[model samples]
Target: MNPPFDRLLADVLACRHCEALLPEAPRPVLQCHPDARLLIAGQAPGRKAHAAGKPFADASGDRLRDWLGLDEETFYNPRRVATLPMGFCYPGSGRAGDLPPRPECAPRWRAALLDALPAVRMTLVIGQYALRWHLPGSGSVSEAVGNWRAYWPRPAPLPHPSPRNQLWLRRHPWFETDLLPALRAEVARLMEDPAA
Candidate 1:
């Protein structure tokens, strides 16, 4: 029997509702297994990711993998972890970094995609947009991320893993000192568990 998730994914890939609004038409990109154990929810793709048709396929991916204590192979393995952005397509770049993801993508697809990944045990919400969407009423990004404990056993908020934010990382040493160890341990535990 084919799983309903296959159809759900197909529908997402075929989306073109925002085609005319985009500089480039939507190319929704994501990776997951119906039985994935972990989900990495992030902002929209950058130009590089859009071109590559892979999530986080640039320097940002390097930092993210370092944070997770994972290699590219492990991180991209759908059975182990899934990568689904709050918005899937690249939303074009601003003067600084990439523009915010298209608002339409999430409201249209997030719930359905999440519902399809029934085995997801943990969701790592990265960046302000993801934090806002997943952890509503949490106030500022710092406040929401600082209170990571509140979402224990399910979702964990994280700063965007972009080299562009290296200054932020340096200024907030406690993120590495206090959170990285625990985060790594939790990830290790999940990876080690056959049934996870």
Candidate 2:
């Protein structure tokens, strides 16, 4: 049988696998349940999300929620949706933005975590880092996101919802015009699935 959710969550909350390397104390921010139908596979938390101990607690999250056509209550409900970041802890800032998720995380924890979520019907693979690991050699974020049709029933790729990417969004009008509608439709379909 799979591990109980509370027990697994406690262990993950107490993890210190990257303690010595982290900029701050380890605070893994993710939510999951065996019955969830939707999974938001993202990169690590930003400073705001780290502070809140929740993934996607910033503008990026707001935009992401809008894209998925999900309200706060539904999106945050563990039974309805699960969130798993490539890196659980926040990887400090760099010259550009927050640094990439620590390489140690996904290899150490992803498979086990995924196994626990037996009912996940759709996973939204957000950002380049997540896309790299989940959809390797899948080309750039834009390319992967643009080819949303190919990753069906597995995980659909998406650009990070950060406001910093406004330029990219403006340039790639099809993302908003073409992709968001499909993403919302898929999410609605998954939420309505009785098997989920």
Candidate 3:
């Protein structure tokens, strides 16, 4: 059966509501199959990803793959996992990090996207913005990510895999000890059986 999500995704890719506000306009990059079991919801693309028109094609991607125990090929495979962002385009950068994702993309597209991925068993919400949107009212990023056990079988908040956050990782050794193993195991299990 052709899942309803295909149509929803088509609509998302066609979206241009905030084009004028964008520095390079919205490109809405994402990858998924209707039957995907794992969902990776991130913040907007960095300059690299926006330019390349691929999701997670930078240093952050390397760390994300490491955390998930996936190679580039497996991470980009749509049948096993989906990579959708809070915003579709590069929202530029701030003094500390990249700017927040454009507001329109998620409000306009996220529900439809989530509705379409009915088989998704785990959602890795990367970065503060993604965690805020996916797990709203969950307090600060540290709070939400720290309480990873609560969002089991649905969404799991993760710190951004960017090298910029290396200091944060060093401070929080428990994340490596506590979360990475479980996250990797779940991802591996899903990749092994997309239907699971």
Which candidate number has the best lDDT? 2
lDDT of each: 0.85, 0.89, 0.85
Residues 1-196 of candidate 3: C-alpha lDDT, one tens digit per residue: 5746667777777888898888877777888788778899999899999888889989999889999999988788887779999898888887987888998888788887787887888998887778777889988878888898999757899988999888989999999998999988888888886457
Best by the TM-score measure: 1
Task: Count clashing pairs, candidate 1.
Answer: 0
Q: What tens digits encode model 2's per-residue C-alpha lDDT throughout 95-177?
A: 99999999999998898889888888888898888998788988999888878889875778888899998999999999888
Estimate candidate 1's RMSD in Å: 1.3
lDDT of 3 at 63: 87
lDDT of 1 by residue, 1-196 (tens): 3468778888899999788767797898799887678899999888888999989999999888898899888898988899899888888877887888889899999988888888888899988889888888877767777888888547898889888787878888888998888888888888889675
Question: Lowest lDDT 10-mer window, candidate 1?
Answer: 1-10
Any idea what lDDT model 3 has?
0.85
Task: Enumerate clash totals for all models, in the order shown.
Answer: 0, 0, 0
Off by more than 4 A, model 2: 1-3
Which of candidates 2 and 3 is the stronger one according to lDDT? 2
